[model samples]
Target: MKNELWQLSACELAEGIREKQFSAEEVIYSVISRIDEHNPRLNAIVADYREEALIAAREADRAISSGEKTGELHGVPVTIKTNVDVEGKPTPNGLPAFEDLIAPADAPVVRNLKKSGAIIIGRTNTPELSMRFTTDNPLHGRTENPWNEEASPGGSSGGASSAAAAGFGPIHHGNDIAGSLRCPSFCCGLATVKPTFGRVPAWLPSATAERGMLAQMISVQGAICREVRDVRLATRIMAHADPRDPFWMPVPFEGWPEMPEPVRIGVTTESYDHPIHPDIVESIERAADYLSDAGYAVERVATPSVNEAAESWLRYVGNEIKTYLMPVAMEHGSETIQQIFEWFFQIGGVSDAEDYREGIKERTSMTREWNLFLEKYPLILSPYLMQPVGAWDSDTKNIEELRKFLNSGIYSLCVS
Candidate 1:
């Protein structure tokens, strides 16, 4: 039982627990110790649940001793983003005003994780209302990037990314709508996938009303992990059936058969007139090369207009945000979040009612073009961030900085 158990992936931990090489309690202790050592400075796991996790771990060990069947993630310690419901825990969503709004039940993904025998060690931080690109809120403070304190950990799932990178646990729960999951993973140098909408069920027991249509379509639950295999494992576990969400499909995790050999991958470095950093371009090229070397027929091919899709996302989803989320930001958000919202409104002008309808019509056409293109190229390698990671507070300093920040992630907001 070494402290290095915290470094094991979810798959390795589960295997070790099943083989009786280590008790589930030992793994939980190791991860909790790691969190205790680093989370004070990182502020990654904002709410500690180590005691409950230990109890769950002991139960998992007993289940093994009894020769009971176990789930795929048995005994693995993980963290949930603060915005998601975890029965009886407060889902403040980085707003102090909602600090007392405890969830009556676990969100769908949380329940699925528990069913997979994953033990929740803590809850991670998020931006105010989970809207910003960095994880800093008046409620829980900021989550620092483990690699560089000054650089962002990426938000609004920065806390999850930070915790994963810090070795607090192997798998962390995160949701993305416009890069919440992807951006944080990119910043913290972790692995994640913004699962296609409907791939995983989602619902918040604490929500007073449903989210906007765009939010419902774009937002998805995902896992942030140190390894890609763990991302797949956690995502598969989280994707288990949950009847609460109508979008939850019964499709198998590996629904599609294996693709033909030499899969054709489309590589695009198009910056849409924005000045992309050389390092970013180099990274994209390097990845493309790796894919090509791995026997994939990689080619630099342009599909539909990403710029147009991004613009539509900015104007349409932006308006949806203004219509649904702006009131909450106005009423409960901090001054910084409020100002950022205003700047977002300025950069992506809110559409009038007629324009909103038009945007939906335009979105359908855009989706069709992408679907048709995907039939030719199943995978596309595109830039996540056009520049290197920015400072933690770059998006909130002023409107210009925020605009620059958004411009750097033009690909992140769209292409869902």
Candidate 2:
């Protein structure tokens, strides 16, 4: 029973602890044993907090014994992505040069998780500067996919996904700027939701400066888990209000009134010049069928232009990266990372200063179009990546391959 504890979902663990079926210490030790067995090979967790975690678990057990009120995630173990703050821990973000940059306080997501009684067992790995889609960095090395070592676990939340799939923990905190959360989940066969923008509060106390405007809008914090229920639970916990992030919304998670009978679901398979993998098309069709069977009004239809939005993302974000982040990358980033940044510029096409302002303005129009479409069809079912998952290093191999990889993610980056 102790050994099997590591295999349970966060939901299961929380219930078990709440019911006194098992002490939090027992569950933590089970997960620690699992990590000891697998982490050396996978390198998913860069910083293990075994001693600290055990202490926390014991405290949680004591609180339960005292019959105190418990939080939603009481005693469930989770891993925080190294990019975010964990108070007193270094948020290296997979960069070696900033190894000493310790955080003074927990980021809002971490605070929420802790407040909900979740214990952090470790900090997960990420690519240098959390820029790449594949997880490898000078700070913590590469995190291997548990299913296929040669395959990518996905980045910049690759470490979180790998750890979650390997049973290091049930909930792994991750943030998505350009599909960082979903891409890793997709690669690792896990479940995650890139919560609507402003749904989850975000802030890094150790950051030297704020991110660019576009990045602030697109990037969001979330969790990856083995079960959709765990994902939903973690997402709700992470959405708790934080005074630090002014963008955080106070909206309820599930209080919306029921839609008219046969809720509309707009389905699209538009690949737009990129080869749409047959498996992806079949997946979409199957999902639409399932929704229809479940009483949804699923319709095959053309929606707004994902390609145009994707292009806008590239141009606007590429220019911001060039202006704001390139200098830092040049100063502290590895050569491989620098080369990848060059390819990003090549594929994304940096906009001039004049065009950059105009593009920012154009974003409003693009968002308006998507919002209007969503008003008619409350839900959209579309292919996230047109092609099947590629090799871990496919994006860094050459310019052409990189472009193909970026093009494949048109739906993902554009939807954000």
Candidate 3:
């Protein structure tokens, strides 16, 4: 019996399948079975194509046996956020009116993943238009956190984070505009990386709005992984320039050295006036101190001002998501969607166009400041949140609390 059913990383499984210690089909089957065993309870995976996945796995095994060379991720199982397309699957983004819509073609990221030999097993749920953090929408209901079931796994990439954290896959593809990748990893104690903007391709059909300035800054497609090595792996595999996204640079992925040298490390204990909870504060201190102990020069600094950029970023992002919901609001005449749009427009309108421009200036200044700081400091160790992971309380029972919970993570992480 080839007992390959458990928490092995992608590399491990790929090696196992290559050596014939186990079949890629076996791994896909095991993952599907495990997800089926848990998904109904958590409501994480909204639409699963287990049969297709298993068949693909079998084909992968046959190809390997035929001595055909496969990409780096050959025969590995993985899942994607529902916001992106998968050819035949629906890219719902959690809108009920749009459930029938299907992608005629795969998003560039999906194409690369398949080309790299990753097996597509499932498409996970996301908040409506992946707007807010917690994974809840009309289409998929809600996706519970795997750790402390009551707590949020963090979103809009919440499902991807939960699946990866729960051992559903070695790597779950996700995107980040505001801490979507990093916040969940913080909540789950998983390692995540937010690559510089345009390092990864993003060509989703559901996106009907222009990229705005976020095209240049503050948006990235990164990974949440258990090992730093996987961060490097995903970057190497997916960071290649996709001309589809003209923003992507025609540059090769820069590989990290065998050992990153101990350099100047900047530490920010309080990025905002937001008090860091003791447990989280201690965690930050420990991380900062570790770098110091490792012989890196540590410098304490005040949190950089992110308020202006945050306001602009929120308005632009909120408007984009609301625009995505506009068609739904029209078809179903949804009170929720309409009201959300009204509120979004109200706030966005209040910002004079020049105010938006000023915010961009603020963002540019901050980025330059960070760049200058990094010029001397090779690394910056900072907190992903103001608090520790707490179980979600069902009693909260209101969208207001959910709103607060969703914004708190970004408020905590933004200043630096």
Candidate 4:
């Protein structure tokens, strides 16, 4: 059981612990040992908490023995991405200058995870300021994909994805402003949901200022997991109320009424001429087929042009990045990251102040179109990445590669 404990999902681990099939200490030991064995080469988890985790596991076991109530994630080990605040730990966000900038307190996501009885096993890596699509930085080096050493694990939350795939733990915390959560999940063949904005409370205790409007509206905290059940469980825990985040919504995690009989699902393989791979198209079709076979009324339908939304995102968010975040990148980020930022600006083409205001006004129309479409078809099955995952450093090679990388994820950016 010790040897195979790391392979279990969060739900399974919690149930086993509750049933006294395995002590929390045994589970922690197994996961920590697995991390110790493989983490050196992967560099997925930069801030290991093995000693502290073992102690917490022992306490969890004691509580269980005493017949105390346990949270849904009790005894399950999880990793926090380095970008989020973890009390007393450095939230470098892969920047060397901020490598020693310790967090004043846990972010809402961390607090909620702790309250849910999840053990913090380690802190995963991210790209500098968590801006890029690939995970590599001077502070944490790089997090390689377990499936292929040369391929990217997926950016921003790449470390979280790598850790999950390599069997470090059952759940890993991550955030998605654009593709941070879904990209890594796609690359690692895991499960995740970039929850609707305001679903999961989020805040950085060490932050000195507020984020841009687009950042505040779009960014969301979430979890990456090997199983969809674990994703569902972890997301509910993370969605717990927090006063620190003003945007956090009061929403129930489950118990929603079922959809009408024969739920209709919108299916689209429209690439907007972005050069989607045939394999990717086939995958979407196969998934639509599966859903249809499962009693869904799947139909090919056109909603809104994702390309237009994506372009708007680039113009609006790109300008915000230049105005608010570019200074930090220019001053402290590495040459590689700086170059990537340039490519982002060049491709997105920053909008002027008036144009930005108009774009914001126009964004609502786009959202309305999607909402109306969704009201008719409850679910939409579409391609995440238009093509397969690329090499780890493909984005940094040159402008052409960077544009292609961003282009591949148009669907993800459009939603964000």
lDDT of each: 0.91, 0.92, 0.69, 0.92
Q: For candidate 2, write residues 342-362 as lDDT tens digits.
A: 999988899998998999899
Q: What order do candidates take by lDDT, descending?
A: 4, 2, 1, 3
**Candidate 1 positional error at 225, Å:** 0.3
Q: List candidate 4 segments past 4 Å from native.
A: none
Off by over 4 Å in 1: none
C-alpha positional error of residue 388 in candidate 1 after TM-score superposition, expressed in Å? 0.5
Relative to the true structure, candidate 2 reaches a TM of 0.98
Of candidate 1, the 10-residue stretch with the lowest lDDT total is 253-262
**How far off is model 3, as Cα RMSD?**
3.3
Poorly placed runs, candidate 2 (over 4 Å)? none
Error of 2 at 288 (Å): 1.4
Candidate 4 has what TM-score? 0.99
Q: Score candidate 1 by lDDT.
A: 0.91
Residue 147, model 1: lDDT of: 98
Which pairs, if any, clash in model 2? Answer: none
| Residue-wise C-alpha lDDT for candidate 1, range 1-416, written one tens digit per residue | 46799999998999999999999999999998898899999999999998899999999999999999999989999999999999999999999999999999999999999998999999999999999889999999989999999999999899999999999989999999999999999999999999988989999999999998888988999999999999999998898888999988888888676778778899999999987999988999999999888899999998788778877888888888888888998899888888888889899888888998999999999888888998889999999989899999898788899888888888987665
Instruction: Write down the TM-score of every candidate.
Output: 0.98, 0.98, 0.88, 0.99
Error of 2 at 124 (Å): 0.6
